[model samples]
Target: MTRLDTLSARGRDFLGSTHAIMAGAMTWVSERNLVSAISNAGGFGVIACGAMPPHILDAEIAATKALTDRPFGVNLITLHPAMADLIAICGKHDVSHVVLAGGLPSGAAIEAIKATGAKLMCFAPTAALAKKLVRSGVDAIVIEGSEAGGHIGPVSTSVLAQEILPVIRDVPVFVAGGIGRGAAIAAYLEMGASGVQLGTRFAAATESVAHANFKRAFVRASARDALASVQLDPRLPVIPVRALKNAGSEAFAAKQREIANLVDAGTIGLAEGQLQIEHYWAGALRRAVVDGDIESGSLMAGQSVGMVTSVMQVAEIIDELVGEAEAALSNRAA
Candidate 1:
């Protein structure tokens, strides 16, 4: 059997592909072009439906279908206001998979997606939560760590794989965060991960719609340059987001301090102050991704950004990863 065939049955079956690699859905960057390119390249691509309304998601799904007939998934943030409608849109398109991200999915949302006969995937930050998600009817689990881009949990992918991979027997577990090459993929599969997901590695693919300047930043960055957003005040609520440290991130720190001062002065309620901080990042991702304003826009990236050296085609990236994986497995067996 080939190295691809050596993957766990659950992994191959869940992805329905020769390789179990997945191109992680990135906001603004994972629209029709990148999603379809990855799927056509024999890896699953997920559309990042980050905070998009129902109509926009419908259009994007239709556009992706126009590009390729291969199976793909849609990733929706659990906290989206129109989540129910978004799930309905997936059903309407006969989408094969739905990945719920951001936070714990509501029971109703889970049921709605399951009712569509679509495979439901969720992010599990801990092994305990992995079990709970399976019990709650999630078909697959993606264990993502702080090394990932955008919003992140507090654990590393290696630690999460060790903790969750062995016990989550009911469903396939895919590892994400800081995975930049096929050697890591092979190692994780050996450790019981059914597949792997990568965002930073794929963000600079030729098919990706990220602005040229944005991709350049990724190529030039080192792992040390990718830092998680910091909270200035202990009392205020802050959701840590991982991204390249640039002018935008520095400004975000100042913005938080300003908001915290307002809260201390009672000029704004604590909740409102938190909301203001959230609003500061609202369109920042788009500005960086689409407009190429890297300095002031949030250049969200994972630690793996350091591994990206050039812009290659999606098919080339997949082939490189799989070849590296096969070679690793071969060397180990020898």
Candidate 2:
């Protein structure tokens, strides 16, 4: 086996994929076509169940299954109202792996997904949460740093890796956020990351169903263009989103101000205010990814987006990443 394969054996076996790399789930972009393409390309693909109801997710899983026989996973938002029903849907589909994200999953939700016998993965933003997830019967933990697109925590990928990798050994720990190249993959693997997940690079993949304009925007953007949304009020509790700067970012700031005022005036409860923000993001992302509204749609992208210079096929992307990783390992031995 190649040195890369040897180092990634644990992750490869766990994921039942040729490489330890996983395609990060991006809402509106991670539908059936892209998910199946990633799985077919020898990396793991995850269906983004962002704000999707159970029936839609059920149909999407079935469609992805129809396209690729390779093992792929599904990502479900923990904050969704029908999270339990969504878990049941995954169980019905007999999905090999189920990723719980968007928030810390409840004990019941964890047990419910585990009952389906699917390998369970959850996002851990800190070392303490990583340990807690392992103790709560989580099969794996994905640490996505602040550099990631969409919703993000406060730490960088390197810091999260340093804090969690050596400490969490009982279950495989996957490092994500700002990881776009094989050398970065090799660096994390050397740090004891069982696997790496990338989204921005894959969102521009030729196989992705995202609009042509959306893909173009990604290719044109540099790292500095992707900025995180600021929190207008501490009481509103907005989860910061990372995306390419545009009119949509400014619109979001306005939306936050609107919500904050509503909360201040007792027009909506804190929970309702948060829900409105989530709804707004889901709609805005659809406009950009599905309708080609790049100027005003949410162009969610990670810092690695600057690395995405062009649209490439899924196979080519995976091959390049794997080759880069292999070269990195080989050079280190010299």
Candidate 3:
């Protein structure tokens, strides 16, 4: 096998794909077209089931399956109210992998996915959690850092890798965030990463159904344009979301303040307030991704946004990534 394949062997085998590269399950953008395209291109595609009801997710999985016979996965938000039903849909469709995101999954959720005979993957913010998830019977672990788009934790990808990779050995560990090139992939693989996940770069892919304005915005953006939101209230327990600076981002701060006030006034409890905040983000993202409302919609993107210079085909993007990784490994050997 070639250098790229060699480095990605474990992850590739686990994913049943030619490359271990996974397209990050971006909400609104990671629907049937892009997901199938990635899987057809010999990379893994994960359908983002962000707040999607069970029926919608079922149809999505079916649509994606019709488009490609290649293996792909489904990403389900752990906190989604229909988590159990979603897992059942994945089982009904026999999805090969089920990734749990948004928050730590309960044992019941883990068992439900595994009961479907699907490989289970969960995100870990710390090494402690990595070990804990492994002990909980997760088939794999994804360590996404603060530079990642959408919701994020405080640590950087490199720091998380340094802290988690050496210590977690039982299952495949995929590193994400701020990784826009093959050289970065090579570095992580050398550090024992099974593979990598990228979202922003793929968001502009020709196969992605993101609106033209959305693609254009990503094309023109720089790394600095992507900033993580701040928590306006300690009681609200907001998760920092990294996205391109826009009116919608500023609006989110105001929205948070408003929700926090509701929490203060007893109009809504913390849980209900947080749910409203989540719904607001979902709507805002759909506005940007589907409706082309760039100014007041969430342009969720990673620090890798600058590298997405143009809209490219999914196959082309995967080839370029593998090529870059090969060159990096070759240069190191030389």
Residue 216 accuracy (lDDT) in model 3 = 97
Task: State the lDDT of candidate 1 residue by residue for 77-140, as single tens digits.
Answer: 9989988899999999999999999889999999999999899999999989989999999999
lDDT of each: 0.91, 0.93, 0.94
Which pairs clash inside model 1? none
Candidate 3 Cα errors over 4 Å, as ranges: none
What is the overall TM-score of model 3 with all chains considered together? 0.98
Cα lDDT tens digits for candidate 2, 161-231: 99999999998888999988899999999999899999999999999999999999999999999999999
In model 3, which residue pairs have backbone atoms overlapping below 3 Å? none
- Which regions of candidate 2 fall more than 4 Å away from where they truly are? none
Provide the lowest-lDDT 10-residue window in model 2.
Answer: 231-240
| TM-scores for the candidates | 0.98, 0.98, 0.98
Could you tell me how far off, in angstroms, the CA of residue 106 lies in candidate 2 after the best superposition? 1.5
Error of 3 at 259 (Å): 2.5
Displacement of residue 324 (Cα, Å) in model 3 is: 0.7
lDDT comparison, 1 vs 3, better candidate:
3
